[model samples]
Target: MPTSSPIPANEFERVLDLIELDLDYTAQHESFEDLVKLAARVAGTEISLLNLIDSFTQWTISRHGMDMEQMPREDTVCQFTIMESDFLEVKNLMLDERFREKSYVAGDAALRYYFGVPLKTPNGYSIGALCMLDRVEHTLTPEKVELLKIIADEIVARLIMVQAINNLKYDLNEAKEVKKRVAHDIRGPIGGIIGLAQLISQRGEKNKLDDVLQFIKLIQKSGTSLLELADEILNTDVKSIQAAPELTEHELNLLVFKDKLEKLYLPQAKNKSISFLVNINPENGVVPFPKNKLLQITGNLISNAMKFTPVNGKVTVDLDLELKDNAKNLHIVVRDTGVGLDVPKMEAILNGTAASTDGTSGEQGYGFGLPLVKHLVDGLNGTLTVQSALGQGAIFDIKLPFN
Candidate 1:
């Protein structure tokens, strides 16, 4: 008598994980169910199942006549069937010494026959088996077994193709989301610039030299913003943005930060007739931070301030280095004298539930800016605080550790 050998627990687990079968094991595939039906017909059996063996169980990914979706690994004949590379057929469960004591044989189902072909991947892992079962003793011809093996191959091929299709769809959806975000972020600055340009053109002969200069500066700022927007879009890999590179030494520079901020936001404030101030005090020579992420944070805050603040209102940005607990931390504060937010509104904004509203000048808001800023802030291992009151003003404080 041939004894059935049990697979080692650790190796079984490793193979199961490597197969990645759990992803689709519970999913309904009409084609796969049809395959099970065809398998049962070809083997002249009363029941059929496409079973994937997990660490401790046999999961019926697809089935034709089985009422149960799963069974204990010890109780499943598929377990031993998966051990071999080819088809396994038990002539009669009552006659087979290894399976005669099994519960299914002695229970209500009264199983009497079994035939299964291993579903093997190209990488040589037998993930599971396509099996047929019968309640009466039966025999399978050599030709039938060969046909069963071919069907098993077709089943494996279908599963692989379905998984590939799913992955491709995921990637496409991700790219669309990234494109939508980029368009939304760029729209605000572009719209502001267009509005300012139209205003300049309408003023024509009445436009003063100083006013024209400010408009030009604002337009220049918008163009620079577009460039920065392009940089962010180009550098972004939607699939891997979550694991973006950390702040690196070669990428950090205090001078570039000061220059970019002044160029980007000062004109925006001027166009809005808002008093804009920036103070940078870097005690260290090198400012170690993710430059693009910092730009996104500052750009969103300053843009919001410019949009909300009325004429003659003020916006101030302060950046300094602090020594706390023997570590150098960067401190940033952006305060605005604008129509501030109520507690609920503030909470909603921070929690990404707030709808965007028109600015003081009727400029449209993207509503994603603050949420994106918060995401980037958290990515940098920083903290953000918002302080505001209706009809008063708003302030944003950020703290990031450098060392």
Candidate 2:
């Protein structure tokens, strides 16, 4: 039997690897504000940190009510707290010999009432600590410690999810890069070969023009397939990054949706003889949103509709605003007269594995569109539901609360 190796001495180094591993995930925070806020809230502390211990520094992935991003590890009391492999709540560090002299407790990022919960990775390694601190000492009730532990668990879950998504993204990127390198380099030569073949076939005896056109069409089709592959490969990275900006109130109008979605998928829809239109109820509303995210969600729907609908079929989009007791919500519906899916297929859509059909003109694509759409919608705290009939049409209902 193989013996297990000792755990890495540097937790920060380990977590740095974790962060890197999670960078490609959709849940990977572009910033760690949520974690910081959660830490502070759970511990009821004036300051909190999602701190990772490095070789020489205590790096703060997130800090509530603090400006510092890092501090010397030598000065970090949280470092000592994390090494314990258990939850710690020091009501007053000055009275505690272990941390009283620590500069993090005695000096900067000053600590009085200190609480830290180790953030463990899936393999039972402590990657970091979620710490809450106050400048003044106060007694910590057991309930507070339990709450802090819960928050730490939340942080761990978030980080793990980020890591998982990052892994998927990594695999996707690797596949994409390999495919691109193979296809891009081959496209030029393939095009030249097909072009030359067409020329030779055209110059041959009568009635060979059709054969040449068929060969050229096949080459062009292959080129188009490469283009689609390239788009999916790149979008796997661009679309998957959880870079949605903090929510802000914005004016979302028909024109905005049109300029964003209609302009995006209109050409594709037109090529399929699919008519796309937008209908806005109360055409204008102030709903809090991350504009880029909203755009991404709608783009998925519009594009999906365009891809699935029949030639001359209409894809209708409408936004309805509801204000109840000052709590506002936007109801968005996308109705398409297309080759509507059955119940099992709709469940597949929810599971993010539904296979997509070609557009009216046999437009080809992979099946990632709706999966990404569902993910973006969920990220916005929205609910998405689908209704469809096999031959009649499909309806997508998305309801989102304003930020």
Candidate 3:
């Protein structure tokens, strides 16, 4: 009895690295089609394949004289080909103990000849194979074997280039997200200064010297905070930006939180001629939670609401502190009157698969806001739900437990 190749110790890591390549399953395979065809023509074989063997499936990335896309790894002769240091060649698969009972050999296809070279990565992982096959037995000359090996190297080089391109694209996206996050984070303090300036102007002659001095102090404080936040966000590394924010407990003062929220969004609403309301129940007290993450979640929600809401529309953010089952729970509701969401869009937002789209005022949204909110909520052991229909507006509800 012939035994199958032993499973590689780094199988899981190999699969993860393969996924990191972000291999395009659509038109990318066409790039390898020519290579496979060339292999078949050189070896005088009827079939040729560029195969990538992962843990569960043997993906035929490119094929000639065959219509297969993928199949179970357990049922693939190329699986053994990947395990070989040089190459595996069976002039007659029917006479080979290891491959004789395979479906392609004993069954309808009746493939006899096989010659394959392992597709090895730079990191020394044998991920797949480039193989040529035929119905009748045939021998591959030394020159043809060397030619096949050279073709396999070309294929591996192409794969490496694809992976590098994908990695560059991913890094670019991450950088964009970092900029969006910084813009979102700085809004509160910057808006505080603008709102405070407006307040000072409104108080004109009636403003006391003491009040004016206090406002100036507030402006200075907000400016300092904004500078700090800008520095931190701008200096964040790509790896840090890609990672989820840690859930760390801190004291959350509800009144201060509400005031900050008002300062952040009220002026924008006023400029847009929209109604913005911040209502907080039991707006005083300190609770333990991840303050920054909660702010991120709520800020994203409210900013999105205001962005989509039209002039004269209403956008309200309500924060309710409730005691249920001897535990403290915070409920946040952001309701907006705007062009609403369809089922597919809503599902996509929650699933983090939504694409960036233009807002009502032609404002470009990051498309990642709601998804990041969902992620933050989940990280904090919270529940988030949404209800909306097209032309009916949207309501986002979030509930977080504070023990």
Candidate No. with top TM-score: 1
- Model 2, residue 153: what's the lDDT? 80
Candidate 2 regions off by >4 Å? Answer: 1-30, 104-110, 196-403
In order, candidate lDDTs are 0.72, 0.64, 0.75
For residues 226-282, what per-residue lDDT tens digits would candidate 2 score against the true structure?
Answer: 677667656643222223222222234444545555544566566567788877764
Give the Å error, residue 95, model 1: 1.6
Task: Return the TM-score for candidate 2, rounded to 2 decimals.
Answer: 0.43
Query: What number of backbone clashes does candidate 1 have, counting pairs of residues 3 or more apart or in separate chains?
Result: 0
Worst 10 residues of 1 by lDDT: 238-247
The Cα RMSD of model 2 versus the native structure comes to 23.9
Backbone collisions counted per model:
0, 0, 0
| Alpha-carbon TM-score of each model against the true structure | 0.56, 0.43, 0.50
How would the candidate models be sorted by lDDT, starting from the highest? 3, 1, 2
